[model samples]
Target chain A: MSENRPLILVTNDDGINAPGIRALIEVMNTLGDVMVVAPDSPQSGMGHAITINDTLYCNSINVIKDAPHKEYSCSGTPVDCVKIAVNEILKRKPDLCVSGINHGSNSSINVIYSGTMSAAVEAGTQGIPSIGFSLLDYSLEADFGPSKKFVKAIAQQTLKNGLPKGVVLNVNIPKLNASEINGIKICRQANAHWEEKFDKRTNPVGRDYYWLSGEFVNDDEGEDTDEWALRNGYVSVVPVQFDLTAYRAMDELNSWELK
Target chain B: MSENRPLILVTNDDGINAPGIRALIEVMNTLGDVMVVAPDSPQSGMGHAITINDTLYCNSINVIKDAPHKEYSCSGTPVDCVKIAVNEILKRKPDLCVSGINHGSNSSINVIYSGTMSAAVEAGTQGIPSIGFSLLDYSLEADFGPSKKFVKAIAQQTLKNGLPKGVVLNVNIPKLNASEINGIKICRQANAHWEEKFDKRTNPVGRDYYWLSGEFVNDDEGEDTDEWALRNGYVSVVPVQFDLTAYRAMDELNSWELK
Candidate 1:
């Protein structure tokens, strides 16, 4: 590791201008020399997608004040932003990569649809210690004040003690007053899902259309889950990895007939 | 279970007109009632994205002949298609939702970026037995002839015996002749990744741009991996799930100091 301040790369799924990323940039500014390379537009549910089929355009945007950090807006997904940041922008392998203070929760099943988590996962895949921060609130005016200290602490800790290889942290902060917020809790991703309800309507062209709508349902009653942590007004940090292999079921599945 | 033919929902990430989906549709027609609600345009690498920010349109199109399967071209992501198909199009919950016969392999880390696998995962979340099929080739004219029998067999088996809840199969057929191909192998996702190399170029206006380029690097030497199966010319069947929890690391992570 470098003797100077750690090089921290910051990005988010909620676009570069979102209040969430701005708050994150402010917090990360206190920790190290930061660089912001995020999407030009909101890419919330992009997952781990990269822009392979199209050319990517990135331009340095002057957004932050006094902070020596560089910022760029990229026309790509969150994963694409991370890849471009690591491979194109940064001079060396970053000491850490942090994504989000996402506008919404990516607590459980929502992780699969999250561009924020995917950026962190992309960083992890490239052997960088990373974390994706999110708030339980989906509102544009969601309070992120409670998360500032927690985000700084987590970043400082990760910088002091590096994470395990292939493991990145998924941090979800409960939307609460800084004083009312409970302590941090490291937990597992809860068993949860979206019960989809599409609102069908007739378009101006007389064609039927639909809008995606859903309600999150958390079924896991376990107290040691991210969902539980948020519910109790605590910041939840779940150590997440990219290996989707369900190792426990591998042997059982192997026994099944392939013919 | 119903006594009549099972209601099978077929879709893909490569758009409704892709040859891979056509091959899959052909195989599905032999087994049961197939309803295809695929993206109107290509959605490869869309991952688990849904059209939440925008409106979605699904138009019933007449494409294939003699199949008698109802098909709709959706203006949304792969996951969105599955959601609309389940919530609006299908009168009842489908027995199966099969996505892809994808133009490329969705093995290992590719699953993280696969719109095809996302469709399958979405179905599994809805408690429908699902599978995502892919070929080893990425060619538009990639032959699906050799794998049809195996695809039919697997779909038939899945229909006959339901998959465990929360588990969906990611099946990648080897791009080889039936005679050259070995049998199916139930495997784990390989610890593989793309080593990204951005192709930089200046546009007409002298602005710099990048084209995402990468080569798949398989570091895992495990013989039981999906990468191994594909390399050995065998069809790889990896039972995948939407749960992203790294269960083994939960306790260890919790031991970290929060203060």
Candidate 2:
């Protein structure tokens, strides 16, 4: 942005060795000087967690041999990697920060619980223009072909236009081939909730234990929603902000007699 | 609205045995039928994380002496506690959910990383009227004396006047004596972030590690903000929403040439 090749910081929640971050690194390399500091293990549902209770471990890795990028693997949540990168790893604030080309969908209400989006949100809070990309596919071998070009274009657009202050992008690509995919659509987060069903089981000692499993239930059918766009074969791009303030509810709260 | 006493869910990020939750439990007991399912250990900065990768362990615990409320100690994040309560523990969806009389401030940017607020946000997603309470003091012996009446009044008001759809409250009390404290002021989350200063340390074996630490820096001077209210000796109440979508920026994103 300052007439220099933009310093782009890359990271993700699916761990450093995931194919998704590999794809992201390649795309980021084509865009600018790239530096990646990502988690060492998969952290899918980590949300906006930071490593405050425990010590964090970070080590340099040679993931892409001879590639013109510096990458490190940190034993922390996605949000932690971003903090470590900006505060301890990077020489200066990055011009842009991109998180994920995630292994699964992070659309709808999933954004709140997504470590992918949380990394981007963390960067946005620190004045970096940021975006988190996800594909509807959830497998290790999922194809990132269709999403690469779109990811490049979005990153380029963000670099050129700059994002709105306090906003980051949540881009979800539908699980479809390049040709079958309709372009990208700017949309809002569709309202949704997980119908949680804990799979109860007994340990070897006969104590009860549980595994959390949930079915995503979409409650909003609005056409202008991330869920709708992805379902209709479009890569949905939702601008997300970290300011959780519900300004509209302030008046009603103020009306209460608190004296 | 129902003839039966309102079924109230109480939870916090500070573990099941924290004095803050104990204070909250005492207040909620006066207004409704309370059930508490909280983390067995402190989960202060856990955010909205869930227990997905690991098996969850939840066991009923007698937290208070001859207390009428049923309590469970959960080995999970605060968000997990809410899910377990709603989907497994509680007989039905709760009428109201209240999280924390947290030991520290969750005002401004801290809300994004707050386990207390995350518990409340999880309940709001379930269509339950919810509120999170925090005190400006961060101490094991922090006085919740001044906050009890306010906490009761707010929770009572939430039971009486259901919160706006998709919204929950983030209430923070100033650390002052009840007589010295000003009243409550409904406000918005102040624009701010932790100016991160990672206290990097080397382990006994000479490996690099970090303990996350930071100072709360207030960048917003708005009089109608949580920081301002807290600074002025008033308990700040900020209405929080889980919808990460930045609706105002949708128009700008739409103009991007993503094709």
Alpha-carbon RMSD to native, per candidate: 1.7, 1.6
Q: Model 2 residue B180 lDDT? A: 77
The alpha-carbon RMSD over the true interface for every model, in angstroms, is 1.4, 1.0
- Which regions in candidate 1 have their CA more than 4 angstroms from the true location? A1-3, B1-3
Maximum-TM-score candidate: 2
TM-score attained by chain A of model 1: 0.97
Clashes of each: 0, 0
Residues A22-121, candidate 1, lDDT per residue (tens digit)? 8999998788889999999999888877787899999999985665778999999999999999989999989999999899899988888899999999
TM-score of each: 0.97, 0.98
lDDT tens digits, residues A1-259, model 2?
2347899999999999999999999999898889999999999999999988899998989987799899999999999999999999899899899999999999998998899999999999999999999989999999998889999999999999999999999999999999999888999999999999999999999999899999999999799999999999999999999999999887888788776
> Which docking category, incorrect, acceptable, medium or high, applies to candidate 2?
high
For candidate 1, the share of real interface contacts preserved is 0.71
